[model samples]
Target chain A: MVEIESMVPIAAVVDLVLGIATLSIISRSQGTSANNRIVGCILGWILVFLGLSYIMTSILEFRYGALADFSAVDRDKVGGTFAFTAKNLLLSSAYMLMVLLPFFFPFRLINREWDLWFLLAGVCVACAVFTAMHLMTNFEHFQVENFLFIPGYVVLISMYIRFIITEARDNDERLRKVSVVVGLVLIGIHGETMTYWLSQVLSINDLFFQRQSIQSGLSISAAAWGGINTRLTLGATAMLVLCAGEAWRSFKVGLSPFGVLTFIIFIIGFVAGLADLAVLDVVRSCYETQCEAFPVAYTIWYDFTSEALVYLYTPILFMFILLHYDIVDTKREENRWLIRIIVILMLLIVSSTILELIQSFLPIPDMISSAALAIVVGIFIGWEERIVKSLIDDSASIQETVPDFALPEIEHDFASPRLFNLVFGGVTAFILIVSLLFTGLGVLG
Target chain B: MSSDDTITSRSLLVTRESRVPTAVALLVTVVMMTVTMVDFVGDLRATDTFTSNTPDWNLTFDVQNYTMQAVETLQDDETRNLEFDMAEVIIPEGYSLGLIDVTITSEEEEGISVQCDSVAGDLIENGLTAQWNSPMSNLSGQDSSCQPIELSLQVYPDFDGRSITVSAVNEYQAMQHWLQDGWGQGVLSVDLELDVNSPLGFDPIGQDTDEEITVDVTVIMFKANISLVE
Candidate 1:
């Protein structure tokens, strides 16, 4: 029997490739406007940090068998293994980036000028405090520190909603529909987190238990349930459906072939990942009594396939952003050829996943399936290189232009600069001092 | 210019004054906050009970003693057995019994061991049996065994003003081969201890009574077994 531990390295390598591709694409495209640059750079770093975190986590899990059973108290008293500590540090950094990137992305988008030094400093201090807390105590023990990250993301989503609503109000009927759909998709993606935060504030277990009870009623195992609940899976699925609807509407109104192709790839990846999770959920739920009788290798394959699909959606989103922002405008002929290549690569990835799923049921070796996936990924990397080269070559001749994003002008009261600085500085310093005092007390105790 | 550009320019020209959406958002947020606050307050109130309504009392068992003789019959069967009252529990007037518990402890000497596999009482049908190996060995004075048994009583109206009498039996039988070999001899001393407790309590969600009272009773038992050679 093949151990699940051996699969981690392959997964890590795949994530590493994805991270490199994202960074490479963002770097090569070097947005024509300041706002685009800020958004692209922040998002690219977010991807890099998240990818590194996952790679580290996978390596730790591979070496330690599985760290799921270890408690925070166990990690603290024993000082954890070196692999575990490094993994925690990377994960903490990833979470810190996750919170920071969203705030900056929206701020840069809304304000043409990037002059939020004080806000950036506050965020930096908060992230530093969180990192320290996570290091001193394990993630499980630092619930307060984990929770502090939520408000930033919540504010980010709220800003996006406000932007969408404003755009919907001002735009034409077609654009309005698209804006509303995207707004709903954003809400759906962030709904679970909002519900969780509300439940925590209300001190109600029922809010959490309701989801558990529904899963239990369906007889879904915890692992399958977790896959369904994961933010990446849920968010990607919602976005894929919404984007497909938008694409259909765009087609009726005559959209570019490139837009249709992007949506098609997005839909295919989402469906493939969702189908994998659904099949696993059904099989595991139905055979709850005899789940162990099911083949372990197939389970691992499904897990990897679902995870890869979810991760693949990130790059696809980045591509959508690039296209939407008009940062990487391809010539019509080149765009058509690139679209064809993308469609083919997407099909290859989907087929590879389906084949893996089938091999789990049949007594077949995975060598061919693995090779097919690797070859497709290699082709994908080469295709990405071609696009990057094109984008770079095109960028040199194209002059930077003013961004077209509109901001609603509103009259509001304003505090004097000196007063604002004094108050903000005082509050931030007080918070920092209190945090340091508590941390020192904790260490001494 | 595109339709998007036209809409943007038009929107920019008009001084946007619509507040319906903003009002709606604020209203929703306020309602949600109010509901959460109410729930938290309700939880706080539920936990702040200064005194409990349930009645609490303890019943102790007194010590008692008995003797038994083991005699071989014509069939060559040697047996000895004795039964005695362990405790009597009475519920106070206008009060109901919420729970009843009986505890038993036994000890014996090196040559003989005492085991109580079952107990019988008025409140319980037949008796409760030890679900495990509950023999008490007195070979060492430091070793003794105690078991707590809960009487399964019907809920509500059935347990009102109820009185229960409890009893247990200790039996010793010599091996037929030992009797046939004429090896039965000497006296075996066994000590038994018992305690009964019943609390007359009012259900928070159920029927309430004005009177709250406590009753305590104690009982004990001692037994000796004699093995005589025929």
Candidate 2:
């Protein structure tokens, strides 16, 4: 019963609330700009709307359960079982967006100094597209939704990539960067899974549009994502090691008791997020029972991505706070060492970006996209303005006249030929080519 | 483009201001829509569940007769002592009742009578005939419309150990009346246990009242027209 209930959309309400609360907390922390706050508020509204839908759908599910066991039903009642299921899934996704938007609400892009209502208006357009997708999904007009929603989703992803690259980097720390990378990767995986699911639902009655080749590609892409998860986790483990250094650095003189608690919670959240992804994989498998091996695996990978993102909530929130407060500096001498570590991260990001592009054409796995994104963020931490250098430097300056630590001195002769970035970049590119060749057979064919 | 030029520790943090992506994303969205349209239009008439001209049948079975002996007590065990030495059963031909083979015996006689009946005519017109010439008999005969037979044996044995064997090779129609005693495949699997009346009065035997005679009848049928479907 608990499993079934958990599967239901009811928990989405709690997620929405938590998401909104996190934003509020970020806002109250005082460093966030007004533009950031507005973005957050809009996202919060979206979350609330999504949460309501989840709650409504959950209630509808309850009604369905009640009616199913009975021998009789109302004669006039229309739009039967499929309608209900579609409604739940559609509304739940809209609510999922609600739950998701606040976490990475593109606030910095909207500025008090500049009139960016056009951008805000763009947000409105994205929301409208999302809402349309939601409606089409609920009505089971899957192909139509895919035709519409994929573009909407792609647009959203591109905007987010730009947003993160521009606004988020300034104050990033290794830990926060790791969290963002992991979160975005998870998001990408979710998108891919959604795409696969949509494609299947759409292809139910159609054969001539049988993109068997695309299907084959998606399968391999999903598997590649699985391989990437192992890599990402390894990257995360490296980040955790770096975080340990951060903890040690802050432990003696600068650490607040609350900060330590938050850090611990963040670790817990990361672990929880990983577990959630595993669970989501199982859920995806359940739905993809009839699908071939590769597609099923890919679907599962996509599921893992979403679940991981959702579960990584606390850590992501805490890391954001830490970045905002200048507690963990990404560009600090210790943080600069992460460049060697995050080469794999960069590789993951680049590979994923390529895969994402290819998948747009041939339906490659989303996990790859996520891995690429994660790696990108992982690499980005070394240079991110908002998270690693700016905020941390500002905070460090407040405590003591800290030196400009943007560029760290290399202690070893090995630093002259920095291979970390190169290796990661090369590997990521190689993976992208491999994935493309496998999925986009036209490339290999 | 440079790895160091991008990324942030705060990048993991989803800002309250994180707005939805627009321009670049919208263009991608439009392209995806186009692809979807092309796919849809291309497969306009092809659906999953299409079918034609194949008879769908499922395998199943039918249950028939189920029965048990009505009364086992109505049985007789006194074996009749007959002196018949020669007996013959004749089955008509052209009416195809298949093989009509039979055997006859007498308890008192050292050599029992046996014979094979091979007659030719329509069974409905000529009927089945069994003839016997016995050297020893107290009195004699019985006859039926389907099979005309006149032969009888008298007096029960003292110990009641006397045995009589009747054998025949017959087709389904020849044994139709007897088969009616038990019908259908499942029900006919077990042999019928019936009471056979003892021949009249040879009294005053010892109280070894275990007077029961069992005769096993094995009929090998050659042909049966079984109409399975209606």
Candidate 3:
């Protein structure tokens, strides 16, 4: 019986590496314009916050022996671990960044002079409120923060639809750039839920949650359940909307690479929903009889689809959005080498992890897997230059691609890379210290 | 390339011609969100109840106690052996047999004579499925001068009055583990022995050579009840 390995630690390394690389690029972006630099910095810090959060999660998983044993009811499992508290708080902070991201990125929707201050204030107030709420209630309301994703979800989805429509209506290829960026942002935030689109549509995701609740002896509150439903609804709705929009565009205009990606995800959701139904007995085992383990086939299916999408591929998605959209300045000679290394590193890392995951379930020999990994590394190394060139060759900011749709440039000196570093760096420190104090004082697990 | 075509977030929603459509889209979105929430709440409540429609009340064990008494008598006898089939003893419903204890005594029949009797009781391990090796199961006891001799045999493993916490999917499931069956259903053998002594060198032959023996047997039984500590 091969158990699913914890990807929290691996995700931690990937996020931190990509996140630090992104921020480093943003900090040294002297030749980039203010708006581009600010947008790049925001993207960088989103990854950074997620990276730090994953690190805390990995620590907690190690200390608790496994991450599956999370519960709000079990005292030793819940309020007793410090890393648990810090992880949620940090994640909520990341979510704050996510909620504010779409307003500025691709194009600043609300271009007020005080927009930066609003973004800053939003993160601070939201993080503080969530941290306090979790501490007061012992994380019973952790999912409540999911509500914050609402504004961002609506923005991303609406923008995606708007651009796709405009692109098709006017036959402007440039509008696809705007649509693609918006699509990538949607994936970055709601990718996990989007994979459950079929399950959410069938309204069976709630059964899975009920199974988890019974298994962990957690009594999920109405508010928590509502939060989960809200996220799933958003994700499911987004997937449906995208599927429709992309199918229309593909039929009306012909299939593009982005359209193909959307269809693939659509197919995955359909299949995953069927798989989830196939294992309904295993899922209900907690209630029917003693809890039962899922079949290896089902577990492998999940490992490849949802888990891979989340832990391994999301950072790649973000990186793509960064470079392919010209959010990160890829043209500089100084940045080129670093970007090349990150690309190759991410490719090799993802390939090796996938091979290892395959080995966990399949009866593949270690030597064979190693050789496969080596081959993958060699291939990536050989194609590194072409991959980087292809990625950066047409990397143009949306303003340049769709200058007609782009907002007029605001020439004010927006906050620099240093200010973002300071504020977000302070947030990181606050999370660490609060987690430490809470854990030491036995206030929360 | 002109400012007229420059798109803000508002351009998608803010059109004199598109206002009604935008309102409809917003209305549909809000309605769908609300409907999704209602479905979630409904499913959550429905999933909470199992296919069996089990009662929310849980079944757990609360330690309870009861005892059954059996007695036998023999007149002018030196030794009396009694065989009791415990299966014949009708234990109450929802109760379990825990252990059995036996006592033997010789009635004072030496009227004005300097005579004494030694009595012993032995509870032999027979066809009973019980804790034969437990230190609490005393098989034999002896006493002098008609003092009561007591012996015991353990019928259940670790049976006590201590309450237990049971976690199960439902009341019916918990009941499956609590209601035990067919453990104390065998023959209980009690052998009572007495050694009689005559007056000081008077009737040395055979007169007053016997003593009356009495035996008392007790079967301890228990039933477990439940409390909802969840």
| Number of the candidate with higher lDDT, 1 or 2 | 1
What lDDT does candidate 3 reach at residue B87?
71
| Highest TM-score scorer | 3
Write one digit per residue (lDDT tens) for candidate 1, span A1-445.
Answer: 1223332344344344444443444344432344344444444444444455456556545554443311111232223444444444444444444555544343332242323443345445665675566545433233233333434434433433343345444543323322432333243223323223322333342222222222222212222223223332223323333344346545454454444543554544444444434444333332221222224543454344433344444444444444444433333344544434443454454455445655655656668667767887777576766654453343321112212433432211221233333433343344345434544455422
User: What's the lDDT for residue A284 in model 1?
Assistant: 34
Kindly provide the TM-score of model 1 when superposed on the true structure, using C-alpha atoms. 0.43
Order of the predicted models by DockQ, top scorer first: 3, 2, 1
Per-residue lDDT of B52-161 in model 3, one digit per residue for the tens? 25444344333343344445444344566788778777677778887787777667655457577666778877788888889888998887666777788777776644
Please state the error at residue A300 of candidate 1 in Å: 11
lDDT of 2: 0.31
Better structure of 1 and 3 per DockQ:
3
Please write out the lDDT profile of model 2 over residues A1-445, one tens digit for every residue: 0011222242344435534453444334343333333333434334444444345445544664422101111112312333233333344334334333332333232212323343334444444554444333332332222222232233334433443433234533322332333233333223223222223223221221222212221111222222222222222322332234335435533454433643553454354344434444333321222122323334334323333233233223433333343323333454443422332332333344334434544554667556767767665665553343443454421112212212221132221112222332233243334333433442211
**Residue A425, candidate 1: alpha-carbon lDDT:** 36
Instruction: Give me the candidate number with maximum DockQ.
Output: 3
Off by over 4 Å in 1: A1-15, A25-32, A65-89, A100-107, A110-123, A135-312, A319-403, A406-445, B1-230
TM-score of each: 0.43, 0.34, 0.78
Among all windows of 10 consecutive residues in model 3 chain A, the one with the lowest summed lDDT is: A66-75
Q: Over the stretch B67-88, how does candidate 2's per-residue lDDT look in tens digits?
A: 1221112123332331211111
